[model samples]
Target: MSLAGKVAIVTGSGRGLGLAYAQELAAQGASVIVNDVDAATAAEAVAAIEAAGGTASAVVAPVGPSATAKALVDAAFERYGRLDILVTNAGVLRDTVLWKMSDDDFDTVVDVHLRGTFTCVREAASRMREQGEGGRIICIGSPTGQRGNFGQTNYAAAKAGIVGMVRTWAMELKKAGITANAVIPVAATAMTATVPYFHAAVEAEAKGEAMPAFFRHDLGFGDAGDVAPLIAHLASDAAAGVTGQAIGVGGDRLQLWSHPEPVATAYREGGWDAAALSEEFDAIVGERLQSVGEKFPPLPEELQPPQA
Candidate 1:
């Protein structure tokens, strides 16, 4: 996991998981650019990395839109001379049920998570293509989007969209020797603290108790640091062969999610009418649609955030 001579940019690196990622990459011999909307925290983060014998600079800008995206890449080039590993970890959360969710909430989350990710990816890809040394693109994803979560219609849509971007970019960028992947982390961080179960776990930790199993994931046992090493592994040359994957990392656990694909299909001499389609729908696909959570054993209910 030695990223010697590599230049990396980690958005939202002022604190939490992003801060952990920046420090680890720097420790592994990469020059890092710590990006965050907060000037103080971003500067503080850079200072910490530099104090630890690593090279880093702070860029205070909200992630999203082409201009801010360009600024991030520009900072990397100006300070480090090149960019190699880009971790799109900048985001904001606006959680609410669809009916109660405000337009501002929906727009802001999508702006930060979906559009912001694309803007950064677009700029990074353009430069990586010209640099010709190949690079790594690691995007942040969430289980909420993978399995769906209540009161997260907007967040879920954004995260699911991220996986799609990672897959598409992996295919398109591999020709340039670049790899794209998404990492889903189950760790205790400010963003997740908004969710009840994770917040409860955070509280328990404050009391000097172990995180409860109901809200646990392998390798991600309520520690933001748990997510850092995996990011390092993905960004390093050793993981060049791994691409277009959706991987989960947390408290002593690492797992790959199955890509969605057709499990069943049906055909007829001609397209079936509504009447025929209704009669045959269950016969054709009901088995594939059977509930796995209840029948095959669902994940522990604690994985879900407690109802508001």
Candidate 2:
């Protein structure tokens, strides 16, 4: 789908998955506004796009505060005169078990990922609504958020909240014909390179070797570029009918995730109390109880990182 004449803002586009999304949107003929906290990397990203004959401008600032969000939107309008698509991809990881996680760790992750998305979407939505031509809002989520990840309490909460917000926005903005969706992506990037599970793949990539097929197909882990196409698709006109969805992509896999829905429901004549729940709760919803957390297959011997 050609995004020709479209204007997009991709946060944290200085590197990693954000950079990939920005590049792909630009390649598809959109004028991209690249946002990042690091000026040097932001400049590099803009230069890379220009070098590839794509239009891009950089807005160097951290996302979260309304000011920064507004700055990104302003930059887009100032450079491209209008906004059409927004990818809320800027994020940071503060992984820690709940008890060990500090308030700062929790707030930092929530602020950047959850609040940042909210602020940015709020600003972009205002402009799109005023423009009266509809728009696209693509939020970034994670497997940790979809299920639960050990030692990633904060990140999970933020990502899950983002999906929730997207659902709400879809309903609220439907009248304006705007689409809001969340994309859950898994890939090897700066974030995953240090994890033991991806060391072998990361090493192969660093050495200019292809990643093992098993990792890409089975584990749904691949380079950041592997996830970019989905973002572009969601930002295109073809996806106008697709909104309020939590879609997953990575490697060779593309998945449609189900929204939260009750699998079982029980009612009482006079509202069952907790004591009643003790007696009949399991029988009512026990079998329907869903599992939590991501499940991974055992790593093959050859894929294991070499023992240090």
Candidate 3:
């Protein structure tokens, strides 16, 4: 969709997936306000967009605080005169098993990913409501958020909370025509590059070689750019009817995730006590218990890293 004359904001757009999202939005003719804590990379992102003949401005600030959120929205209005889309892509990973995860690790991830999405969406939605025009609020999520992941208690919790907020905002902002959705993206970035499972593919990509098809198709892993088109589409007028949904995207995969709902039901006369319910609980509802955590297929021999 062409976003001509539209003004958008992408948080943490300095590099990786955030930068890709900002660039894609600009490429579609949207004037983008790029937010990042690092001034140097933020300027570089703006320069890259301008070099490609797209409109963009940089806002160098951390994304958790209300002040930063306000600054980003203000920049959009001041630089482009209107706000239409917001991509909450700022995040951090302080991964550790539940027992080893420190309070700071938990709070830090929550502050940036969860609280940042909250503050930014709240500000943007408020202005969009006042402007009396429909808008788009796209939040970032992770597969870990949908299903538990090892050593990702903080990241998973924050990302999951973001999706929860998006669902809530979809209902609250419907009357004003503001649509809210979460994008669960998988790609080879600085983050995933550290994962042992992805090392071979990531190394191949760093050497300027194309990633294996297995990564793109089976694992749904590719470059960061692979996930940006979904963001652009969600931001467009065409997606007005698509809200309160968690969408997954990657190399060649596009997924529509199901919301949590009761998969089984049972009735008891006068509400049976705990002992009786415990006896029958598994027999009735446990058969349909859903699996948790992400399931990756077996890796091919050709894609494996060579033995040293």
TM-scores of the candidates in the order shown: 0.89, 0.97, 0.97
Badly placed stretches (over 4 Å) of model 3 are none
RMSD, candidate 2, Å: 1.3
Error of 2 at 105 (Å): 0.9
Candidate 2: tens digits of C-alpha lDDT, residues 23-69: 99999999999998999999999999999999999999989999999
lDDT of each: 0.87, 0.93, 0.93
User: By lDDT, who's the top model here?
Assistant: 2
Candidate 2 lDDT trough over 10 residues, lowest sum: 188-197
Question: Model 1 — which ten-residue stretch has the worst lDDT?
Answer: 290-299
The residue pairs found clashing in candidate 1 are: 218-250, 218-251, 219-250, 219-251, 219-252, 219-253, 220-250, 220-251
| Cα RMSD to the true fold for all candidates | 3.4, 1.3, 1.1
TM-score of 2: 0.97
Model 3 over residues 1-308: C-alpha lDDT tens digits?
79998999999999989999999999999999998899999999999999999999999999999999999999989888999999999988888889998999999999999999999999999999999899999999999899989998888888889999999999999999999999999888787887778977799789988888899888888888899999999999999999999999998999999999999988888898999887999998787999999898877877676665
Candidate 1 local lDDT, residue 271: 85
Tell me the TM-score of model 3. 0.97
Instruction: Report residue 108 deviation for candidate 3 (angstroms).
Output: 0.6
lDDT of candidate 1 over 1-308, digit per residue (tens): 58899999998899988999999999999999999999999989989999999999988999988899999999999988999999999888887788999999999999989999999999999999999999999999988778887788888999999999999999999999999999998778766566464555777766877777654543245577778888999999899999999998876677798898888888987888999889999999987883321111243565454566
